[model samples]
Target: MDTFHFHLHGDVQPLDRFFQNCIGSCHAYLTLREDWREHARLIQREIGFRAVRSHGIFHDLVGIYQIPWGGERVFNFQNLDKIYDFWLSIGLKPFVELSFTPRALASGDRTVFHYQANVTPPKDRGEWELLIRTFATHLIERYGLEEVQTWYFEVWNEPDLQGIFWTGSMEEYFDLYALTARTLKAVHPSLKVGGPATSRNMWVKEMLDYCAAHNVPIDFLSTHHYCADAAFEMGEFSGIHWRGQKAMLHDVQRTVQTVRQSAFPNLPVLYTEWNVSPIHEDVYGKDSEFTAAFVLQTVKDLSGLLEAYSYWAISDVFEESGPGLTPFSGKYGLVNLHGIKKPVYHAFHFLSQLYDEELVSDAPSLRVTRSPEGNVRLLTWNFVEPVNPDFHSDYPLSGGEREEEIVLEGLQGEYEITCYQVDREHGNAFRAWLAMGSPQYLTAAQVEQLKQTAEPSVCDHQRLILDGTLRIKHVLPPSGIRFYDIRRVG
Candidate 1:
């Protein structure tokens, strides 16, 4: 048994709400699918994330570029319009990732991902500039300057990955950034733009120095972090280092400290892509309930460290490497393909219900907050990292049952306590699917069953504060997450 204590009179502060700031998705082309739009609408309606980010806005499928049989290259916005219009209608702003050179404008035939996004730099600098300017001008024309100004224009995705993401030299990337930034800013100085959207938190210092010295236009700094990533330096004296469980937190902290000490202390920072592991086939996050606890742990610790951290995706309708072969194919999405909500989805749902103000508590795994109406909300979890956590190899999570006793002092009224729990037997659709023999294809009935199983098991009751102390007890299974809401009773 473990006991945690808190007093209602502790220090209070504003809850950052960084977890719901933005969510990630597959390439923008996927947004055209009915399933994808349904997922987006459901996520927005339930969790209410402010913005959505994805890759390949200029990819061929979105029809941004076309070369007629008898004419020169032309640009089209019909497909892009369908995508962004749906997002806006559903109350989501695009975080706008400017990416993957159009095949007609690419310097080479190099490509990446299952859909084969052209990774080569632009064939001609002037042509690239024309495309950028035209794109910005068209956006302003369609969405109006006021609406377009609210979106972020990130230069590219993981250009630091070199041959995989950008088949160009470091200097070439810097050149591209300068060209794109200057062109967008020229269209409208108020448009928000940023760059060096590198993986593993690379190139922050150099990017800041280069932009400052060259007088480039950059409104913010954006990068990414994954706990299982390997950190390294690019040029001379380069080396690689393996990260541990706390890697994401440490990496973002290092990036923030570096920026604060540099010339861009006041610049907003965003981890535009992040998750437990970067591997697409990793079930450590997919099928396990542990991911929910992992998300809560990291996001709570990341308060005030960054402006936004976009989870790599919203649903497993993604197909970067390729489409997921099964319902729970270890892909990085809060919801599975059948629209079944994973445990991580519940984690965000619980976090969303928390009040704006936070009350102090000494326990590392406990959060206590109160609303203006005198309702008390508490969230607590028991987390255990997977042993060795191999993305390809399935691993079992091990831990004993945890009994938690929560005692709040100086309360003297009747209150209603409602508990929502997620563990091995609660709010876990993957586990339910497995119990049904891990079917390769599910019937309509099975899908409906799984959806029902995905809901958190909820319990409620009313009680009077016993002698000015309210004591609540709960039993948490391994890697379990629980949320409690206590409100005054008439």
Candidate 2:
């Protein structure tokens, strides 16, 4: 079998305390009237995010756009300084979006989705260009061009869909991008800006070709992919178990390779929006267990090619069929809005748990020893699902409850191997909730219980000593993944 080594990339989000832990924006942040600093502190505690993107910084600016659920609460320049200060305070940067026309500048009353926040682009080309320039100047003046130069400013959100989110044409999107890119660069020149922030490989070719031809000041390439029901409808895969997972990844791999060949050789691919499923139906994360397993394996596959990957939004929200809400339908959340951490969150947690040690390329199988102090990690997958009908994670998993047989070669004495796994029962936390009919809502106390159960079961698997490479037969089932800690016995 072909083997590959990977950097095991971690997804960045403000929804948790990871890395620089910068807090930023969300659809909910729009509803509050809280002091900016207070909001910033809350973000610091909750999201640990590194960047903030305003929903409508460069759109029309006249009549108000109605937010279907919250009424007319989100649009206001009064909170600009407050928002930016809190952003810098938490040490997170801005991923500014030049988007959704403000009602004031919107040429028509037609809005995408329902909120009316989906303002149409400026009817007059000059008016649209002016909006971009004004927004650009405001940023340079407030944050100072030098400091603001570091932020990533994307043009808009998913312009390719063009129904609820945008009522404009693709040609219009390109024109908007070119105008916005030029204005932002002209103001700071050093500021990083790019977009085509559409989904499922939209505009990659046109955007890349356009930038190369017009010298449109492109800096990075970004898009999204959620194997929601709609995604699979676009592409076909072979199997539903292990092969299904490989097939899922195969599609992503194909997209990346295509970009490299045609337009974006130097541009980095940033999946700004992605998750297992876009909406909730059976399980909060429908196929979350599958996504959890794919998380680890795909990182092993795409870490080198992809730069930054952020899951769609932090929490769950009302996905109604109206305006001002997420234009597309589905629950593309990393964590449920209730703040209950889901399996997807934990999968990321497990990936982050892996150490960035120099890998042994020739090592054929997964190897790892458990315990924070232990120095071994062994990783392997059954490319094919485990046929062992006896294996399952029933209740609280303990040390001995997990058992399997494997042949180890090049061994002289006994050794210890620590094991960790994400299986059908253990890794499918979201499904567990679903099977139980989605608890009348898990409380803080109840959430603690679930978090504990979701963690991996680790224990030493006998003792063995080996001098040369060894091959072993082992059993790992539950339709997911597992790891082991191997150590030389004294």
Report RMSD (Å) for each prediction in the order shown: 2.8, 8.5
Provide the overall lDDT of each model, using Cα atoms, as 2-decimal numbers.
0.85, 0.52
Question: Which candidate has the highest lDDT of all?
Answer: 1
Candidate 2 residues 419-482, lDDT tens each?
6666656644565555656566566775666556555555335655555444444455533566
Task: Give the per-residue Cα lDDT of candidate 1 at 186.
Answer: 94
Which sections of candidate 2 miss by over 4 Å?
Answer: 1-76, 81-91, 113-116, 140-147, 228-264, 280-287, 317-330, 358-419, 435-437, 442-445, 458-474, 483-490
Error of 1 at 13 (Å): 0.8
TM per candidate: 0.95, 0.68
> Mind sharing the TM-score for model 1?
0.95
User: Distance from true position, residue 372, model 1, in Å?
Assistant: 0.4
